[model samples]
Structures are given as C-alpha cells and as structure tokens.
Target: MLKKVRVQIVTDRFEAKGSLYETPAGKLLPTPLQDMPAKEDIEHMEMTVEASYHDDGDRVCIRYKESELSGMEGSVTSVSFRKSEPALISMLRDGSVKTALVFEPAARHLCVYQTQIMPFEVCIYTRSVKNCIEENGTLEMDYTVELRGAQAEHTAFSMRVLPVFDKPISK
Candidate 1:
C-alpha cells in the first residue's frame, strides 16, 4: 500500500545585515554569518510538501516548495530515504542527524544540516496511520509532520506537528 502525506509550513522572520570589516592590509572582509544583509520586518511565507512512502514502510520520498519575498521565492527541496538502520541508530545515539539541505530553488548556495529526532534538531518528522474505515470499506489515514529549521546558529524555526489527511468517501 502506498501513502501520501501533505504538509504546510508558514514562517515570519526578519532579515539580517552582512557584517563588513577592514583587514590590517586595508582589505574588506566578509564574515560567515547567517543573518541577512539588512534588518527588515518579518515576512510571511508558506510551503507545501508531499511525502510518499512505500508499502514496506522502510523508505520515503519527499518534495517541498517554499514561497518567500525577502529570500528565494518558489524554491524547491527534496530528499530520498536510504534504508540504513545502523545509520539511524548511530544518529540517535549521537543525539543528532546531520544532512545537507539540497533544495535547489531555495537553498542552492546554502548547506543545511538537519538533525532528525534529537532535541532542538533541525529536521522533519512524519507519521501515518489508519484513521477510520468508511461504510463501503475504504480506509483513511491521518498524517502528521513536525518540521524544524535554523537560519543561523541559535536561531530556530519550528513547525509543530500539524495534522493533514485525505478522507476517501464511499460511493
């Protein structure tokens, strides 16, 4: 059986300015800072994501697109699941799951580290289960996802578990 889960994310934050400094040789240097180039009002943004899982339930495929005014608009991000229990266990034991965020449209130039299941981890968690059975014998599922991200060190963006599902009506 194949399942589809839909997720929506919204965020509002200000953009920071880039730091400028002069070196001892009178050369301008750029620092590695996560803040934006300038301070601005919090902009509202939304993203819609779809995740598909195989019948065996060991693998997952995800696709997401985000809309932002201050940053990259209409950006997309994707990831594939590798069947590695040991890797997952190791990540859990280490209290962090770090992975590069490769969403071409949004984070093309940025490297994102996602930590799945650890506290303050920057990652997304999803679960699906049979919710109800229709009178005509159609089964429905309830899907939930918890998403988290960090624009910079010590700055976190979080989306708590929000439930979205598809209900198959009987004929």
Candidate 2:
C-alpha cells in the first residue's frame, strides 16, 4: 500500500545557463531564460515536502517562502513522478516546453525591443529520477529541467529527502 511521508529537501545546487539567440541579421536577442533571484539571494533553502504514492504514480507538493524567489511569482511547485522502471522514473510537466516562432513578416525586421510572442510547439523531456529507491529508505533525486527559446528556464537541481520519524512520548 502507498503511504504518505514528510521529508525535507536540501537544495545543493540550482542554476541556469545564459543563452543568446543570434538572428540571421546578426542580432542578439535576450529573454528571461535565466534563473531568477540570483545565487546570493538565499543562504540556503530547505523546503518541507509532502509526498504521496498512488497506484499509477506518485505526487509531491512543495511549499517554500516567497522571499526565496526574490521577485518571482508563486511559492509552490507540484511535481508528478511515475514509477515504471526499478531504478529510474520521470518528472512530468505538461505544456511547459514551448517556444516562440518568428513568422515571415515578423522575422523580416525583428528587433530586440519589438519582439512578438507567438505560440509554437517545443519539445519537453521527462527527466529521469536519479538516486532514488522504491524502498522506505533515504531517497535522493536529481531534478533536471531544460527548456530554451522564450519560456521560463528551470535548471537542474538535486535534493536529498530523508523521512522524518516521530518518537512516542513516555507516559
């Protein structure tokens, strides 16, 4: 039977690489494809996680402080992971992998200031869950999110989750 457990996440490293999209007309375009809240924004963030397992998959909801994000919106991120393989799993995020396509008239005279947002299909990968076990032991996993070209960029992060056990009080 699947059970619920409370764990704490120790964020080891979180960062996003900067990218520059060079146009055919030799122009550099920049976007919010970088990680927000700078590295020095937080000394260290440890968020409490509530995870539950179901028949088909498992779900985890994480809550953190808005101060950690600095200027970013929201403080909760829910992650869905499916357990199919014995040693590996995937983290799913739908409609997240998206890109902006420049049409004919738009790309003809496109400038950094005059950029338009368009809907285009971008590929999203279900990153494998590493360093995790199916048993009731210490679970450690690496979260990787790599999406480019005009959407929010979420870099990879590794966290260690240790189940907290409560001790009975003496009567």
Candidate 3:
C-alpha cells in the first residue's frame, strides 16, 4: 500500500578544512594546510517534508523532495530499506546533484557525485545503520565521506516517518 507521510530528518555534518584545500576546481581553500592548524566545521540541519511511503511487507521505500528547508532544492530523493540482520539501505538523488549511495555497516563503497560543473568519485564508509522504519517509523545512519582520497566529512543522520491522517470533520 502507498501512503502519504511526513518525514522529519536531522543531519549533522563535520568537515575538515584541510580536505578542502584542493578540489576538482583546484585550490578552493587556503594553501599550506600543514602550516595552519587543522580547522574543522560542523553543521546541523533539521527538516520536515512530505513524502510517499510504500511497504510491501518485505521492503520499504520512501520518496521525498529536497526543498529549500533542506538546502538542496530541485532534488528528488528516494530511499530503499530492506530488513535483515543488519538492514541494507540505499539512497538515490536526482537533480542538480546526482548520486546513488549505499549504507551497509562497516562497508566502503564508491559512487560518483555528479554536480553542475563536474562529476567525481567519492568513497563512503558506513559506520552503522539502524533501520526502524517498520517498527518505530525511524531510521538512523552514520557514515564518513572521503573525497579525492582525503577523509573530508562525516555525517550522522536520523529520520522519522509519520503517516498523514485525515482530520475529523468540525462540528
């Protein structure tokens, strides 16, 4: 069955400035990273958006859009989760930036990140995945992103899905 749902997402991202010194565009950040103290940045985001949810008793799929609130406007995201000893989760995004990412505990996978200017390969190291979307309507994941062979960022994300219920008629 297909259902309309409200999906709430909270994501925390950490990045190291040293990794930004040289990107595909070249020399994006300050040079002489060794001379300067390693700088790190952390970002937190929370958003609630409408989504479509489908569960066929074996697998669950959720599709939503990246709105201005999430800072990735013009993007459509879909996540497929399968239940197992350790749940398997895969996410695909299409729009300005496109990528298909897989999350499996203690696994490393490479995927190409396509952007407006260019496309490059990135490595994803998944630390953990907790999928409770079927039991408690929640999902959690932790992973590190390596860009150009440099450990650039780590992200911890959690999401909760709530089915949309019809309101009662006012008396």
Question: Which segments of candidate 3 are over 4 A away from where they belong?
Answer: 16-40, 84-86, 149-151, 165-171
lDDT of 2 by residue, 36-94 (tens): 45667423545555544333355332222222332222332333333543333333222
Q: Which candidate wins on lDDT?
A: 3
**What TM-score would candidate 1 get against the native?**
0.31
Point out the worst 10-residue segment of candidate 1 by lDDT: 86-95
Per-prediction TM-score to the true structure, in the order listed: 0.31, 0.38, 0.77
Cα deviation in Å at residue 69, candidate 2?
7.1
Local error of candidate 3 at residue 46 (angstroms): 0.3
Q: What does the lDDT read for residue 101 in candidate 1?
A: 32
- Which sequence of candidate numbers ranks them by lDDT, best first? 3, 2, 1
Model 2 lDDT vs. the true structure? Answer: 0.35
Name model 1 segments beyond 4 Å from true. 19-40, 47-61, 65-76, 79-156, 159-163, 166-171
Q: Candidates sorted by TM-score, descending order?
A: 3, 2, 1
